[model samples]
Target: MKKTFGLLNEEEQELLNQLVEGMTKEQLLWTSGYLAGKSEKDKKTIKKERPDMPNIQVLYGTHSGNSEVISEKLLQSAKNNGLDMKISLMEKFEYRNTPLLQNLIIIVSTHGEGEPPSNAMGFLDFLRDKDTPEMPGLHFAVLGLGDSTYANFSQAGVDFHKALKKLKAQPIMPVRKCDAEFMPEAQKWMDQIINHFSGTSVVLRPEKADIPAGGPVLNGVANAGFTVPSFKRVYDRNNPFYARILKKKLLNGDGSDKEVYHFELSIRDSGFTYQPGDTLSIVGDNPPSLVEAILDKFSFGRDEEVVLDKQMFTLYHALRNYLEITVINPVILDRYNRFAGSKELTDLINDPVQLADYLYGSDVLDLLTDFPAKLNAQELVSVLRKLPPRKYSIASSFDAHPGEAHITVAAVRFEKKERIREGAISTFVVDRVKEGDRIPVFVQNKKKFKMPEDKSIPIIMIGPGTGIAPFRAFIQQRKHDGIKKGTWLFFGDQHEKTDFLYGDEWNKLKAEGYLQKLDLAFSRDQDEKIYVQHRLLQKSEKVWKWLQKGASIYVCGDKKKMATDVHLALLDIVRNEGKMDINTAKQYLNSLASDNRYQKDVY
Candidate 1:
C-alpha cells in the first residue's frame, strides 16, 4: 500500500491516524461538507446553446419516495447537459399524450410481488389497457427499482419495457433493474442515458467513505468502511454495537406448530434510539454446524487465516461473521460455477427457470454438497457477499420502554432432503441467543411507515404473525401518551392459544380503554382458515365508515401474500359498501395511499 503521508514523522502520522479513525462516517461526511462549503465560490458558467436537442420527459412512480428521488435527480442531471427536459409524477401524467412525447424516460418501483407502486397505478392501468396508444417511433427507456430478495424483483420495470415495445415504441436503451442497494446502479443507468443523448460518457462521483476504527498508521489516508449515511456514532452493520440481551421469552404455548419469541435488548447507554416502524437490525453469525459443514465439504482447515477489511481472522470466524452462508442468490452461484468449471452447474445456471427453482430451495451449503467443489479459503471468500444484517421491526416504542428495544422473531426449522434447513438469522437469534448474551445491533428507520401526527385520529391495523411488531409499538406509545384515539387491531396467527403475541399487554390496554377494538383471527383454531383480511371483510361496513371519517389504515406482513390478500379484500369492501365499481374502488384505495392515509411495511 502507498504511504498515506509521504513526509510526515512517525508520531505525527500516528496522531493523524488516531484522529481520523476516531471519527464516524457521519462525522467524516459532515467535515468534508464543511470543508467543501468553505472552498466554494459562486461562479457563473457560459453555455453554448444548441436548440436542436430533443425534448425529454422523466416520469416516476414511487412507493416509498425512492423512485421519485431518483427521477428528479436524473431530471436535474439532464438539465446540466442542456437536454431540454421536464419531470412529471406518474399519477399526474396524462396517459393520452404519453405516446406524443418526444423522448420518454420512466422510472418506477414495484412493491408487493410485481405490482406497480401506488403512485404508478393509474399509469400502469393506462399502459396495459387496450385503448392505449401505439406509437411506432416513440423512443423510450425504463428503469425499475426493487429489492432482489422479493419475488418479481424489478418485474415492474421489465414489464414496462416489454409493454412499450408491444405498443411499437422504439427502445433507446434496455430496461435496467436496480437492486435494493440501488443508488449506484441507478446512476449508471442515468450515465447511459446521458452518453446516448449527448454522445459523451461521464461517471457519477462516488461518495467518500468514513474511516474504520483500526489503522496500521502507514500514512494519512485511513482504512475505511463501505459507504453509508454519515451521522452519529451508534453501532451499525459496518461497525456493529454489541447490545446485551435483557429478556427472552417464547410467545407460543405448548403443541404449537411455530416458535416465536419477544426479545428485549439493552441499549441504555449505547446512544441508540429507535421509533415505531424502525427495524432492529441484527448482525448474526452463521451457526457453528453450518460453518463446520462447509469446512468439511471443502476439506479446508477451520483455523486458516484470511484478511478482510485489512483485518485478519480465522476461517471459521470469517465464514460465521462475514460471509453469507445461507440463501443462494444467482450472482453467487454464477461466480461459484465459474470457479468450479462444472458443465452441469453451468448449464443449470444458464436456464433461468431452473436457476430460479434451485436458488429458491437451496443455500451456499447446497452448492458444496451437490457439486463437491474444492476451493481454498481466499477463493471461497471472493465469491461471497458480506452477511448483511437481518432487520426485524422494532416491537417496542422508545416512549414506552425508554432505554430498551424489542424484537419479535420466529425460528425457522424445516427439513429438506433428509437434512435440516434453517433461516440464517432467524434460527441464530431465536433458538441460540441467551438472556445475558450480547449481540450486534443497529437501527434502520422506515420513514414512510410512521404514525399519523394527529393523536386523536383513528388507525386500523392489520398484521398477522410477526407483522404485529410495529403495531405493538403503536399501542405502547398510545398507552404511554394516553392518547384517546380510536385504535383497531386485526391480529391473526395459526392458533390463538400459542401465537397471540403480546396478548397480556393488549388486554391491559383494553382494560385501560386505550384499545378501542381488538379483532382476532386464528387460522388453524377453526376448521376453515381465517386471516386478518377476513376480519377486515367482516367489518367492511364499519371499515367504510372509518374511511369516511378520514381514518388511516396500516398493513404490515408478507408483501406477496398477506398484504396482497388484504389489499384485494379492501378493494372488495370498498366496492360493495361505497357503491362503487371495481375500478373506482381500486382508485379510491390508491388515493388513500397517495394521501399517506394507507401505509404498509410489508417485506
Candidate 2:
C-alpha cells in the first residue's frame, strides 16, 4: 500500500490510509478512478484514437435508473482509461445484428418478478428466439443489478449471460450479479472490465475535493449524490441531507382498512431541487421493538460492540439503525445457517417454494425464534446486510412546494403466523416519525418518467392507492405552469368516501377546469370490486380517443398485480377499439413504449 503512494507527503499519506481503511474494495476502485480522472483533467492530454483496441459496445437497461447510472460511470471510466467504448440503451441497440458486434458489455437490471426491464424486453426476446443469428465472433461480459430480497434476483443478467453463450458468443468474464447496494460492486466490475481491455492497469492518485460537513468520507471520495442543473453540491446515499419534517397528515379516514399519510419535509437549506417524478430516498431506522426482540433472543448485551461497514457501534444501535432486521431473505438465511447449523433452515433455503412462503411475511426475529442460534454480537451482525434506504415518489412539485419534498406512504402492518408484522421504513414513517423530526433523505431522479415538454400533449395518469403520489406532483406542476387542459387522471382506492387519496384536491382541480377528465374506481364499494383497469375498459372509447390524440400514458403502482392488470386492459382497448389483432395491439403498445409515449414507475 505504501509503495502505491510513494509520491504523497506524510500528512497526505496518513489521510489516504484512513480513507482506504474505511472503504470497501469496490469503493477503493472507484476512488482510484476518480483520482485518475482528476489527473487526466490536469494534464489535458488529447485522447488518441484506439483503432487497434477492440471495439466495445456497452448496452444498459434500467427500470429505476441504476443501470444507466453505472453505465455512465463505466463510460467515463473507459474514457479516462483510454479505452474505446460506446454506450447505448438496450432498447436502441441493434440486437438482431449481434453477430456484427465484435465486443459487447451489458449492464441490465431485472424488474418485477424475474422479468427484464421494459427497455430490454425486445432485446432479450431476440436472444431467446430460435432463429436468432449466432454471434460466434462476439466477446461479452454482463453485469446485472437487482434486489436480493426477490426470489429471482439478477435473473435478467443470468438470462443475458446464458443466451449469449447459447448464441456461441464467448464471455470475457462470468456475469456479475449485484444486489441493492450495487454501486461498489458495479464499480468493481467496471474496473475489471476496463483493465481487461486496457494495455495497463489504472493508476491511483490523491483525490482533490473538499469534504462536505457530516459526510461519510470513505477513501477520500464523496458519494455522487443527486445533482441539480447547476451541478452544485451532490448529495447521495452516503451523504444524505437531513430534511426537517414540515407536516404529517393522515390521508385515510376512519372505517378505511388502510392507513396512509401525506408527509412534507423541508429541504430549505439542503440545496436539493427535484422535478415532479423524482423519488425521495428515505434512510429510516428499524422498529425498536423488533430490534429489542432480536437482542433478547441472542441474550447478548445490547452494549456489546459490533463492527459494521468498517465502523464500530453498540450492538443495539447497529440493529436499530445500521443493519437490516425487518426482512428475511435467502442471503440472511444462508449466512445465519452457518452459525445456527439448523437442518430445517438449510432445507427451507434449498426449496424455492417453501423458502418463498417462509420469507413472505417473516422478519429476522421470526427467523431467530423459529431456528434458535447461539451467536456472539459480531456473528449476529455479520449475517445481516446494511439497511437500504426506501424510496417514495415525490408527491410535491418543486414549483408548487418550493423548498419541500412530499411523499404519500401507507403503513404496512399485517397479521402473519398469529403475530403482527410491520414494514421497516413504512412503519417507521407512519408510526414513529413526527413533525419537526429530521430524517436523512436524498433525491432519486427518474429521468424516464419526465413530464412531456409540449404543453398541449395530453397525459393519461393511471395511479391507484399510494401510487397516486407522483400524479399529485404532475397535477401541481401543470397548475403552476398555467397549463391545465389535456390532463386526465384515473385514480382508484378501496372506497370513494374514506380511502380516496387527495379527493378534495382532485375535485378542486376539476372544478377549476385544470383537469380535463377524471375517472374514479372505488373497488370495495362495488359488488364486483372494479379497479382502475376495469374503469379503463369501461371508458375504452374515450381512452382510445385520447391515445389517438397522442396522449402520453403513465402508470405508477404495484408491479405484480396493478401494473400487469392495467397493461392487459390497455392491450384489450387497443385491440378491440382500434380494430387490430392481438399481435398488432401488442406491437402498438411496444411502439408506444419505444416512442416514450408510455412510461411506468412501479415498485
Candidate 3:
C-alpha cells in the first residue's frame, strides 16, 4: 500500500488522478483505514498532520479581465500549498448561496466609476439588496483592485467587505485594496493569504470530474500546456494582430502648435467590428531611438537573446516590442537602484520624496542618462514591466466608414527643462512609421459610452479639442440613420483659424442641415477666454427644453476641467431653470445616468 501510494502520489499523478478525481480528505481518511488497517487514532493523527488543508473558494467579481487573472493565480497558489479550492467568476457563482460557502476568498475589481464589473453586476446587486444571505459560518477575505486616481477608489471592495461583515461573515484578513500598479502589493497580499491557510486538512474535488484531458484549459498554462478553462482566449498581449494602417493625415493646421493626427485603419479582413463609441486598443512599440539610447548608455549588446513569457527575443527587440521603457514607475526605479553605478542616483532612489519627484518629472530615458549601469539582456527584460496597450476613441461609424476605422489622436511631444520627451505610442505612429505599415491593434468595447437607440431622441454634445473625436462618429451615425431629432454641438479650441479640427466637414454638415446647431468658442480668438461650458450655459433654455423632451446629453473632453465644468453647467441649468436645490439637481443627474440619458467619454 505504501509503494502504491508512492507511485500514485507523484505531483502530476496526484493532481490528475487523485485531487481532481473526486478524492476528498474525508474519503482519503476512510480509504486509508480500509487499505492499510490504520487505527482510528492513526487516521486522526494523519488528519492533524495535514491540518493546513483548508477549503478555499474564490469568487471573482469583475467585468474586465483582471479578476480572472487574479483568481487563476490564487487557485494555483492554493493548489501548490495542498489546499482544496474552487474558483468561479462572479457571474457563475450565486450570491444567494453565500451562506453555504464555509471557507472562501473573494478577489474583485471595480469597473467604471466605483461600480461592480459587468460580469459581477448581478452578484453585486443581489448582495446589496435586502435579500442577501447571512453567512455567520463563512470565513472570508476580500482583495479589491482599482485605480486610486478615480473618485471611487476600490469602492466595490469596501462595500463588499462591509456587507459581508454586516451579514456576520468572519473576516480572516483585512481587505487589501490594490491600485493601478498592483502587482507587487498583490503578490505580497497573496503570500499573506497562503501563509494564513497553512496546515489545513479540508480537501476540494474538481467541479467536473469526467471532463476530458484535451479540453481547452483555462487561466494560465500549467504542466506543459494543460491549462484550466479560464485561459482559452486566443488574443492577448502575447499574441496580437498586426493590423494594417489604411490612412494617416494631420488633423491640425501646418501653423498650429498642437500636432494631432487623424488615423484610419483597415479592419475589413481582420474580423474586427466596432460600434460608433467603442475604443481601439493599439499594442505599440517603444521608440526605437529611446530603446537604443538606453542600451548604449549601459554598453549592452543589442543582439543578445533574452527570454520573456517563455519566448526568446533579442535585447533590442524585447525592449522595443515587449517591455515598457517610457513610463518611470516606482517599481522600475527600485529595480534599477541596486544596479546603479552612481552613488547620487542610488541615494535618490532611497529617498521617498526624491523618488516621487523623479518618477513624476522624468521618463525612462532620463534615468539611464542620469545613472548609467551595466545589465545583461535578460536581466534588463526581467526588470522592465510588460508593455500595455494604448486605447483611443474610435472616431468612425461602421455604417458610415464601412471597412475603415478612424481615430483622432494628439501626437504628444513636450519639452521639460530643454529635454524633449515624446509619448511612446503617439510618436511611434506619427514620426517613426510610414504609410502601409502594420501596427498591432484590437477593439476594446465601451458598452456604457453609447448613444441612445431611439432615433427620435435629441443629443447635446460638448467636446473641446480632440475630444471632438467621438462626436464626429455620433453625428455621422445620426445622419446615416436619418434621425430627425435635434443635434446641438458645442465645440471649442485655441483659435478658429488654426485650431478647428474637421472644420470643413462641420461646415458642410451645417450647410446640409445635418448639424442643426454649431457653437464655437475659440479661447485665444478673443481677449476673454471662452469654452464649451460657456456655450452650454448660453444655450441653457434650449438645453433644458431638450432635456425635458427626454433628450440625451453627452460630454467628451479633458476630465480635469472641461468635463467637470460642463457637468457643473448642466447641474446649474437644471437647478436655476428646472427649479431644484443642489441635492435635488444631483439626484436628477443620477437619474440620467441610470436611465442612460447622460453619457460621457472624457479622458
lDDT of each: 0.78, 0.84, 0.73
**1-603 in candidate 2: lDDT tens per residue?**
333356887778888789899798899999999988776422113232335334888899887788888888888877888877888898887665455567889999998788887889889888888877666778999999988898999999999999999988999999999988777677678878888989554733222222232222211122234232234455677657667688999998889999999999888877788888899998777887888877776688998998875677889888887778889799889999999999998889999999998989889888888998888899989998878889999999999989999999999999987878889889877876677666678888876787898978999999999999999999999999988799999999998989989999999999998888999999889688989999999999999999999999999999889999999999999999999999999999999987889999898
TM-score of each: 0.72, 0.84, 0.69
Q: Model 2 compared with the native: what TM-score? A: 0.84
For model 2, the superposed segments whose C-alpha errors exceed 4 Å read 1-54, 199-232
Off by over 4 Å in 1: 1-109, 120-145, 157-241, 268-274, 303-315, 339-357, 372-379, 436-438
Writing each residue's lDDT as its tens digit, candidate 1 over 502-583 gives 8888888887888889999999997899998899999999999998999899999887699989999999999999999999
RMSD of 2: 16.1
Q: Write the per-residue lDDT of candidate 3 for residues 1-603, one digit (tens) a residue.
A: 233454464555655565446778888877777766643333112221224334677888764456777778777878877867888887777554556567778888876567666556566677667755566777888999976435566888887888788878899998998866455467677777777887542322222111212211112121134322333234433344445577889977768889988898876655567777787877666776778887787778888888975666778777876677877666676677667657797787678677666676466778767776776667777777766667788888889988778988888877775767778778777876655666666676665678888777888888899889888999899889887458888899998888899999989888887889899999988899998889888989988999999988887878768888888999999999999999999889877865768877766
Worst 10 residues of 3 by lDDT: 214-223
Which one wins on TM-score? 2
- Is candidate 2 or 3 superior in TM-score? 2
Best by lDDT: 2
